[model samples]
Target: MTAEVCEIVITAPDAEWAADFTRTLVETRLAACGHQTPIRSIYRWDGAVHDNAETRIALHTQLIHADEILRLTNQSHPYKVPCFLVQPILSASPDYGTWIIDCTTRPEAI
Candidate 1:
């Protein structure tokens, strides 16, 4: 069976924070992997427009893990309002999809 998966997009103020945040998700089995890239962001907040340099991380993982990922981001992200986007992966190579499922599932806590 093709396991359900998704790509989660998150932005950090810098590469250091992006690396640390991505590592935390992978270490906790919340994501199978994260791809980071430098980006420039322009957006409006608090009735003002702002532009900034940021690091973007695209995380691959099982769909089931999205909620927990959001929870963690809410608790630890540096921005008062962080960017978190979960996009569905409609198709993936069978092996890769299975790998994501395997990497993200963990034994339930006692």
Candidate 2:
């Protein structure tokens, strides 16, 4: 069975932006919760390899909100190409799955 929830990963240039973005998603009920962590990113950009310190926020919410989350991130993120990865939760405790659904707003309701 397909899971009813998902985890969306987002990376920001700094902690402040990550916090703000996380808050926005939660406040708007797009995400049930966000866990932030500091991470080092090594990537190739513009024909050059770059290493940078970044803040990663993992947002947990209903799978139904993925598209809206993607749209919002693209619209508000500072980076021209922000990191947004949505991965389905293949399995979760029944209680936790229920909590996620309860915490997030249904798209039709907004």
Candidate 3:
């Protein structure tokens, strides 16, 4: 049976933050690919409604790496609470799915 691929989405304060975090994840083989973009966010914080600019990072990886991704992001992100959301990619082309698995596969321990 094929394993599921996940697209882990995170929102950050700016483009630099998104890109840097993405780089760390990819370098460690925690994610296969990452895309980033600027986004406007509207939400309540500290009991006040606020609108702000944010950067969104979408990372493609196998489902098995989700926890490590979240743990690393939580440790590295500047926000009191970073936006880390995971969505299962249920219909990827067979080749793309295999690619995700291949890139994100955990390295064997010595």
Candidate 4:
């Protein structure tokens, strides 16, 4: 069966949390690579509009492993409602794409 590439974006309250979460994900082989960027988010929550600065972690993983990845992320996340957005990769550099697929595949040690 052909493998699919996917990117998932998760937001954390701060950079420290983002780093910790991303490290766990990579160490567990749930993600191939994770990039964290600082961002300012403005949204309504509990009937109040608010603005806050947050860190966003984008995870590169495989489609087949999406559910497990999300499950683990939510379990470890600090927010009551963590943001987990998944996007399919339409196309990518062949070598990098292959690497993403290889990294997310089931490991022999697991």
lDDT of each: 0.91, 0.90, 0.87, 0.86
Please give, for residues 1-110, the per-residue lDDT of candidate 2 as tens digits: 23768999999999998999889889888999999999999999889999999999999998888999899899989999999998998988888888888889656686
Per-residue C-alpha lDDT of model 4 across residues 10-89, encoded as one tens digit per residue: 99999998898888878878889999999999988999998999999999988877898789877888888989999998
Model 3, which residues run further than 4 Å from truth?
1-3
1-110, model 3: which lDDT tens digit per residue? 14578899999998998898888888888898899988999999999998999999999997878998888888989999989999988688888888888777768822
Error of 2 at 47 (Å): 0.6
Give the best candidate by lDDT: 1
Off by over 4 Å in 2: 107-110
What stretches of model 4 exceed 4 Å from their correct place? 1-3
Q: How do all models score by TM-score?
A: 0.92, 0.92, 0.92, 0.92
Instruction: Look at candidate 2 and tell me the lDDT of residue 100.
Output: 85
Worst 10 residues of 1 by lDDT: 101-110
Error of 3 at 80 (Å): 0.9
